[model samples]
Target: MSQPLTGVKVLDFSTLLPGPLCSLLLAEAGAEVIKFERPGQGDEMRSYEPKVDDDSANFVLLNRGKLSVAIDLKSPEALSQLLPLIREADVLIEQFRPGVMDRLGLGYAALAEVNPRLVYCSITGFGQHGPRASEAAHDLNYVAASGMLSLTAGNDGAPVLPPALIADIAGGTYPAMINILLALRQRDQTGRGVHLDVAMADNLFTFQYWGLGNGALGDWPAPASGLVTGGTPRYQVYRTADGAFLAAAPLEDKFWDNFVALVGQDANALAKMSPHRAIEAVAAAIALHPVAYWEDRFAGQDVCTSRVVSLEEARHEPHFQARGLFDRSVTTAAGGTLPALPVPVDAAFRRPDRSAASPALGAHNQLLNR
Candidate 1:
């Protein structure tokens, strides 16, 4: 749909998950996001597992609504094309190590000379001038470095690896998108460009605001012993009889009462018991029912509970479909259709456009420089 950010051009000089995701958010909001990749391989994700020739599943999810413009940055002729385009761009996003962009002479300073109003953003594992700015790390490593790993664990169990990339998405992708949007707003008023140095590792700390707040207020060993971690039974996950799970996070007294009242859980589980025992009680109560039974009971209730859904099952979930979450079309290479995620916008305000399918490497070379 042609929504807000319509006609806004984004020069995406980023690759992999976080960078691509940042551009995807802009595209979803109706920007012309042109993705620049290495000359041949394009995004490394294009060849990541779950492939069909060049269409890797990971690539499709991240690269949707984006046009691929492959160019060799090391080549002067290829790099020169950015001069004209950056002049026209409203925003430019890139994910690279600190000095890499500077070496290519395509860094924020270089581009600002040609396009003063360009919003240049760089997403990195560390920020542009940090001690670890040039350190090599992936999502897992970023989380570990940020101390997020230390806080993840069951009672006396091993530290658990989260199923998703929180640092990359929550830290890198989310912040970069927001920074660009903020920069865009500022550019509208100030008519000046800005540089955003976003670090995925830094995001891990930000995502732990609740925990960090608790640590600041309550002090040390008691931090995880406070509101969010394993502190209250009202905010925890419990496994059901049939091996499914439900999340219950009713923080306020009224809501917590509603949660435990439904399952007849011990009242002491709420205010006084040690965190471990409190969680155990909640788990015990939830373990008595099949997920379907609780799913029915929790249906119209405000207990802060929901069934933990799988990726595949979630794709077919009726609630999302009812809410029109997947409202766009994804055309397969042979022209078949799959539901593409529409995005967050009011139906009346969102403009409809036939979004062209994502391109192969160097697919839109002729149009890239414009």
Candidate 2:
């Protein structure tokens, strides 16, 4: 089966999670992604912890199936070398702050002039023209600025750090991928490309649609008071006797009834209790059993209850293994194999072989001469 993006060419100039992850999705869908990195030092993510084959596991995981071309963009000869690649690329995605690309003379305007059908995407914290466009922020800051952090407050009323990079992946990567594909379709019709401004902070507002809708009405729910956020015992995490956590989200009445019966709680009492007391009641019941006990109790129960496994445990999960989620592996320079990180692309679109690995710095420097 031919992949959907088999003929598409992508030039990725982004670092860290958002842009690389976006390009990874594109690559998985069969785009020829060329990751442009700095001359000596590569993406900063290469230095992150939990190294594999002397490279950050994160870097290897996100950058597989992409070629690396190293160059000093600040040098006078940069444009002459890059223009050819830009001209051939169907898409160019970067994660620099506003005006940074313009300063380097690799801005969308310049690149688009050379390749009229290029879908130039710029991913930033705020946006190209926003008041905080130039502000420095990471995943946490972007989520905080988007009001998501306020909704994630713990019992002590302090915001808890999210377990995932929701802002980076959801805000930046997913939007960039969607918009770039949309732009490609548009280009097919008009024979002209578009410059996409993917603002991570701005995109996050959509995740609060329910809360925003409530605020627009006369009654505004306080942070952490929404039904999904912790306003009800049906949707919350409970600690097990073994100190592990169980994510209990039996929101529907049927599922909730099952959970109530299994935990030996009165359904009517739980349904009428204050949110605080309801949570306490669930917590108390859950604390009486170890995670393994609860796991056995809830197996095939349709109660929407599951153990909160660690990353290591998740890697070896039976369900995921049965689904063949980790069927592919990328080989390292030292001939070691690490599982290829899964992307959402359909199996028919994925590469049949997974020999593609994260490249060494300037590994494809010869491409510049060509």
lDDT digits (tens) for residues 7-41 of candidate 2:
99999999999999999999989899999888777
Tens-digit lDDT track for model 1 on 105-140?
Answer: 888888898989999998998889867888888998
Q: Estimate the lDDT of model 2.
A: 0.89
* Candidate 1 local Cα displacement, residue 245, angstroms: 2.1
Q: How close is candidate 1 to the true structure, as a TM-score?
A: 0.90
Alpha-carbon shift of residue 356 in model 1 (angstroms):
3.7
For residue 205, model 1's alpha carbon misses the true position, in angstroms, by: 2.3
- What lDDT does candidate 2 reach at residue 320? 95
